[model samples]
Target: MPLTKGRLLLAALIACALSSCQTADKPPQPRFTSTSKDAGSATTTKVATSRYFIEFRSRYALSYGHTYVVFGKLDKNGNMISPEVAGLAPASHDPSQYVVGHFIPVPASTGWTDGDLEEQYRSASWRVLLSEAEYRDVVAFIRKQQAVSKTWEATVNNCNAWTGEIARHMGYKTPGIWLRPQQFITQLRQMNTTG
Candidate 1:
């Protein structure tokens, strides 16, 4: 039986419409296939340690102008996990200044006119006055500073890296203050060597 032209046109249009509707109803397929083998890329990891040197002093009324220095280990999380620190005292006849309660380094030659025995006695007198109470506060503050310092370094902006740590950790959040690592190292070295 030969189909009429009108009937054939109607059948073709219905087939086309059904095919388009079926295609439209289907869900999207994923681009990649499942694989049992893992890719063999090895992960590289790095560990960090925080090292610190400390000096603390006060010249307020009724208090002697005394200074002390302590060096200790710090953990990966920037905590001072060690309870004990190596104590140090200044060289006798060395004249130096303390910046905001931290001692600054002086020239080695300035320590004494003569490496005289008497000068040694004087330097030895500048011993660390460590007590359990003061030690707790000092260590706690240092640990706080260490954690914040690393976080600030990750910022990587020249000004932010320098100033951000001090401002945030020290609670001096006013903008534009720069604190370089070298400056910190110098202060710590001075304190460690001085007292």
Candidate 2:
């Protein structure tokens, strides 16, 4: 017997349903399972990833017998920001626009002269792994520090003080006063042992 239009349409619908009529947007879900020790039962959970690591550098070397200048003896903010000496400074070098933005040419003399090392300084680096929420908190803490350090002075609020603030914000202990560069780096390493 010949089939009616309704019967033909029903047959097509059934065929499509059994074939590949499912929407592509909703593919499949991934599951992770764990078994219990006592009850012999299992549990499935969805795995997620939302953690990352950020590295902050705290570097310094022994110099002038006083404190390591975090970078080099002459790589302070004043010198780096305004390195305008003839040979020691980079003619009209703005340290922020130096070779790598952070690296300021090591001055020739202890003060400022014509022919400095023009090389980068040595430092210690610390890496911290944090969650998304933690990253935001840490960055905000750093910004606050930068704002406060805008009026930093060599005699009082020096480079060591600046790095110390950042380290302290990240849950590390810093010295109260007159912190040396190498010593501060040592403290950072000790605290970031797990990270």
Write model 2 residue lDDT over 1-195, tens digit each, in one string: 356887887676555433421222111122212111111221232112223333333322222111221121112221222222110112234443322212222221122222122323323333344456665675666545544433323334444555566556666566643444444444545544422
Question: Which portions of model 2 miss their true places by more than 4 Å?
Answer: 1-51, 60-120, 191-195
Error of model 1, residue 97, in angstroms: 32
Give the true-structure RMSD of model 1. Answer: 31.8
lDDT of each: 0.27, 0.35
Give per-residue CA lDDT, model 1, range 79-148, as digits (tens): 3344332112122332332111122232211111222222221221111222344445555654554343
**Best candidate, lDDT:** 2
The 10 consecutive residues of candidate 2 with the worst lDDT sum are 31-40
TM-score of each: 0.20, 0.40
